[model samples]
Target: MNNKIKSFLKSFTLFEIFLITIGITLVTTFSIVFGANPLAICSSVIGIIGVVFIAKGSVIGSVLGIIMSIFYIIVSYINGLYGEVVLYVLVIIPMNILSIIQWFKNVSQDKVTIKVQKTAKKDLIILAIATIIAIPIVYIILKFFNTQSLILSTFSIIISTVGTYLNVKRDKLTFIVFILHNLVVISLWIVTIINIQNLSLIPIIVNSSVNLFSNMYGVINWTKMQKKQNQKGSY
Candidate 1:
């Protein structure tokens, strides 16, 4: 039993464990103090963990991402963040699954390290066109549903769409997109918290802070990984 436990624990890095602990502690304390919805707190905790794993370039993160998307969709629905609900349910969940396949198919010889790719100009052009097409459609849906923080919510969908697309392609640009997404999300949640005047929303703020840190770390780490791949002529 001791060996089994140690082996299982070895699967995660020290930083990953630290992030998980912090997420759990924040959620637990906030839920106790603010009478926050336990489900939302739990979902935020899981989502933080998933983001940490994604920063490490692990396909397991994508699996966790799918689970996080489900919980986030539920939380967003209750909060009337219609754009968030649609983004998670319609885009994030499916993209996470696709990311899992892509990452797995691009692993190193050790089968543990996933290779990062670069985005081309054509990719940017395609994404730009897609964003232009998607914005109006998402705006119509959010407007119809009377979504909270309507403009911010619609903007989040746009950011998330670009971020997830880059992630699925293993582009190093994904972390940059995540940084932007995190900013938009922080603003979106802040508006919601102010409007509702609830301390319960504090956990979402904590979650976004952690996500911002994770994305910053991801940018640094993925850059190093890309350099290493380039050194080895791995493309």
Candidate 2:
């Protein structure tokens, strides 16, 4: 356990650690300043930690992701973002579970990072078709639930589903999709805040903003990892 902790800590550079620390501080400060719910603050903190680990291709990220999703579900439920609740319960959690399993199976020589893969053309076609099919179905469901900002909810579902799917595939593209997903989420929550005048939800906005940067970093990190892996040809 001690060794594992050390390895996890050692996986990150000093700059990465500083960034993560800054993210946590900002999330906590935003939540407190905006009078966010305790759950929202917790979710934001966990989410920042989880996503940064994920950016590093660590299985620990998936574990933290599941926990963060649970907190997110409860927060979304209270705010009538039923689309978010359903998406997290049905899609995000399962994909995180699969990520844990797959990451473990594909661990690098360091035994901490997972091997990154480029999405194949066939997979891209399949994902595109799936996104098209899912959009209408998810829209209907969100409509039935009377979700707030229905259009935004539907878009969030599509983006998150595709992002998580790519994440499970260990594709570098996951972060790009997540960057879009975070934008949609930020918009969705901002709408909720305007509708209900609850400043507590601001932490989610802060969380997503932090996520946007983290995912951008994820793209850079994963691209480098993928190139290195390709050169080695060990996979």
Candidate 3:
């Protein structure tokens, strides 16, 4: 365990470590200050940790993603975000599991970090059509369930599904999609806070904000990984 910790620490630069630390600290501090739900606090911290691993193209990220999703499901359910519940349980967790297998099969020479790929133009077109078709269908379902922030919840599922698919496919575009997902989620949580005046939802906002920055960093990091992999003639 200690050796694994050391290796993980060595994989990142000081700046990346600092950025991750700041994110974890911000979520924890905000959760305590706002007296957020205990589940939200757990979810926020685990989410920050999980996403940083993901940004680094590490398979361990997918494992953490599964654990984080459970906490998130409970929190969202309590807040009447049935869309979130369904999205995580039915889509995100399964994608993360698939991601673990995919990443393992597509690792770099080090046999740990994933070898990232660029999404093909044809696939991008397909994703666009799929997203359009999925949105209205998801919207109808969310409305039927009387999910909170109906529009935001529907959009979140669409964006998150695409993002999770890209992640599982090891596409570098995953981070860009997730950045957009984070924005929609931030808006959804903000609306939730306003509607219920629940201070506990503050941690969700903080978690999403941290995720936004992490995904931005993921874009840069994955671009570098893609270039390196191409130069090595791998994947």
Candidate 4:
């Protein structure tokens, strides 16, 4: 047991990478038949786990985080969660790149510990104000476009403000911000599924387009990020 612990302490671990990859792959493949709920669950679980694991200083965890990033964004996009989708495409994608760079630097330090910086009170206030701004944006979008239900639509806006802030800023606030936003999103999903209908092929296809993209992004980026990390570590 001592030797095992020592080995674990001295070496880099990829178990999380493999696990998250397998999960996302399964969730991606499964979304076709099981509908969007299961797919979104995969994304959510990946994100929550990724947040905790990354903070614990796992490179694989960071890789998994990128996967979650892509997964949620895509899921949001597909479910007519337009505002959230936009945040994914814009904020989340850029944040993924930053996370990769940050994690890579840590690996070079010959240590496995990750640092979660503190977030400022001012920043939290800014985030709250952003949410207030999102209200009008949500209102305008819903009014102009025939999007999904009001709850889901509004929730999408709220996530965009909070999630974007968390992804861009690496601090203790990230966890709390993610937790609160995810709860709201989960609530929105539960409400949505309560009235889910068996729609025709066309509707399903259009609805699932964003989800498919989300899975695709997570799988592809995770693979690329892991490969890059591995190569860097070897040198």
lDDT (tens digit, per residue) of candidate 3 on 63-162: 9899999999999999999999999999999999999889878889978789887778899899999999998899999999999999999999999999
* Model 3 misplacement above 4 A: 1-4
- Who is ahead in lDDT, 2 or 4? 2
lDDT ranking from best to worst? 2, 3, 1, 4
Off by over 4 Å in 4: 1-49, 55-59, 69-75, 104-110, 198-235
Could you tell me every candidate's TM-score relative to the true structure? Answer: 0.91, 0.96, 0.96, 0.57
Local accuracy of candidate 1 as per-residue lDDT tens digits, 122-232: 979988998999898888989999999988999999999899999988987998998999999989988998898877877877788788888988888789888888788
Check candidate 4 and list the clashing pairs. 74-214
Tell me model 1's lDDT, rounded to 2 decimals.
0.85
In angstroms, the error of model 2 at 45 is 0.4
Displacement of the residue 40 alpha carbon in candidate 2, Å? 0.5
- Alpha-carbon shift of residue 65 in model 4 (angstroms): 3.3
Which whole-number lDDT from 0 to 100 does residue 41 have in model 2?
Answer: 87
Question: Please, what are the lDDT tens digits per residue for candidate 2 over residues 7-91?
Answer: 7667787756866888889888877687778889889999998999999888889999999999999999999999999999999
* Model 2 segments more than 4 A misplaced: 1-4
